[model samples]
Target: MDDGFIAKPLGRRQIDQAYPLVCAIAPGLGVDQWRAFAAALLGTAPKGSGPGSSGPPAEAGIITVQNALGYMHGLFSYRVEPNLRHGRVLSVDNFVVLDLFDLAGIAETLLRAMDLLARRLGCAAIHTTLPERYLVRDSRRNPIPDCFRTEGHRQETIRFSKDLAVVNDNAPAVAGGLHGVE
Candidate 1:
């Protein structure tokens, strides 16, 4: 029987073990901050009060994949929400691999695990918010791997930014009275 890649809820030990890999991907994060974030994701509130400290911890999920050597290949975190459009959806917030150049089947395995998790949770869809530059695309214009079909996307919001302090002659002014400075 081919039981899929080993995945389970992240405990404190696993969180500690996984922090270094996470830091490699996202630098400048202190261990304390990572601990707090991991705690929140695991539904274990921190000792102090803060915005995330209150409110029943969101339905968050984290899964880490290990290679044959027992080293981590990648991990992903998501939150489950009741969606009016899709009934229920799993919103993937973080999907990290040690190195994209050498995925070594990690991406495929992890994504399949995510699919199983979504189905187990009764989620109708899986959504992710990756930046445009990081989006993976093949020649066929598929951003996702062939294991799953890609659904077209709709723009949910328009992001606008203005420089309130820069008043240089080269800057342009907009109707909102904010300067557009590079």
Candidate 2:
């Protein structure tokens, strides 16, 4: 939404520019993934280009760059991954620069990214980490993103999840009463 900053997928060339920003974010992501990240962004950056323009888009991807006021303001890197529980969920893998003081178009841009990515991935849910302040509207309820919101959208509430052992259909499995195993 920034006047000049465009949010597009990370291409080889752009990825090189994004590495320092990403490293500034989650250093654990390492160097190699950053290289591949650039490769992935090329195909995903919006072009309105489709069949007539080229071919089907590439694999899972992330949105990069935020342009505002004719200069690059920040970067928002996001990706969707399998959630085994309710399905896939979006992660705002990186939220760097822009303005720690003023969160203007941040929400809108993120929402736009999520909407596109969610539909593209056919995901069941969208998710992301929000700062505590802007998250709370009027110092009350937490507003995640105008484009998206949690079920309760409470300040302190969190969605709980569990990882269950995936069992084969033919394998019989059961949870016994307390007396059985003891």
Please report the candidate that would top TM-score against the real structure. 1
Off by over 4 Å in 1: 1-5, 44-58, 99-104, 131-133, 136-182
Q: What are the lDDT figures for the candidates, one per model?
A: 0.60, 0.51
How does candidate 2 score on lDDT?
Answer: 0.51
Clashes by residue pair, model 2: 2-67, 2-68, 5-67, 9-41, 10-41
Per-residue C-alpha lDDT of model 2 across residues 1-182, encoded as one tens digit per residue: 34444555544456666666666556567778878765665546455421122433233455554564423444655555777765776555455544454344554555565566565656666656553333445745433344244322223346443435444433344566433344
Clashes of 1: 0
TM-score of each: 0.61, 0.51
Tens digits of per-residue lDDT, candidate 1, 65-175, equal: 775555676777778888778889877756665645445355566666667666666788877654333455545543334333432334454445354656454546677
Which candidate tops lDDT? 1
Lowest-lDDT window of 10 residues in candidate 2? 49-58
**Deviation from native of the Cα of residue 131 in model 2, angstroms:** 8.9
Q: How close is candidate 2 to the true structure, as a TM-score?
A: 0.51
